[model samples]
Target: MSALSTFANRDELIVGAFAQDLSEVAERGRATLDEEVAATAHPYSITPSSLSHS
Candidate 1:
């Protein structure tokens, strides 16, 4: 039981770390995309809201 508990704890920690990394990556990607869109001067002008459904 003790060994199983340790293994589970380790697994949870790894999963939590992975999730944090993924979240950071997603934030960076969104920021880069937003910067690109803002830099682009389109005729109609496409804002972030215009690309969203809601």
Candidate 2:
């Protein structure tokens, strides 16, 4: 959660770079970024419990 919360901010920065317009397409693309996130969730998930066990 900690690591993901951190990267979520970074992800905003990265996505912001490409989100420079107020067009519907841009908004739609931004609104639908969750699929990308969902696909990457497993690799990026870092729970406190996992670290404690390690």
Candidate 3:
């Protein structure tokens, strides 16, 4: 009985840790996407041809 309880607790702990890590990664990904969107929200006055002489 004690062994089963210990195993259950260990499994729960591992699942919790995995969930936390995944949540952190998701949050970081969302933040990165938001930053990219914000950076591209403004339009440049210059044309693509102006940027390149060729």
TM-score of each: 0.76, 0.32, 0.73
The count of backbone overlaps in candidate 1 is 0
Show model 1 residue runs off by greater than 4 Å: 43-54
Ranking by TM-score, best first?
1, 3, 2
After superposition, candidate 3 runs with Cα above 4 Å error: 43-54
RMSD of each: 4.7, 18.3, 6.0
Q: Give the residue spans of candidate 2 off by over 4 A.
A: 21-54
lDDT by residue (tens digit), candidate 1, 11-44: 9999999999999999999999999976886868
- Please report the candidate that would top lDDT against the real structure: 1
What are the per-model numbers of colliding residue pairs? Answer: 0, 0, 0
Task: Score residue 6 of candidate 3 by CA lDDT.
Answer: 96
lDDT winner between candidates 1 and 3: 1
lDDT of 2 by residue, 1-54 (tens): 699999999999878866764466777887679677766779658867778954
lDDT of each: 0.92, 0.76, 0.90
Candidate 2: deviation at residue 1, Å?
8.4
**After best superposition, candidate 1 residue 51: deviation in angstroms?**
15
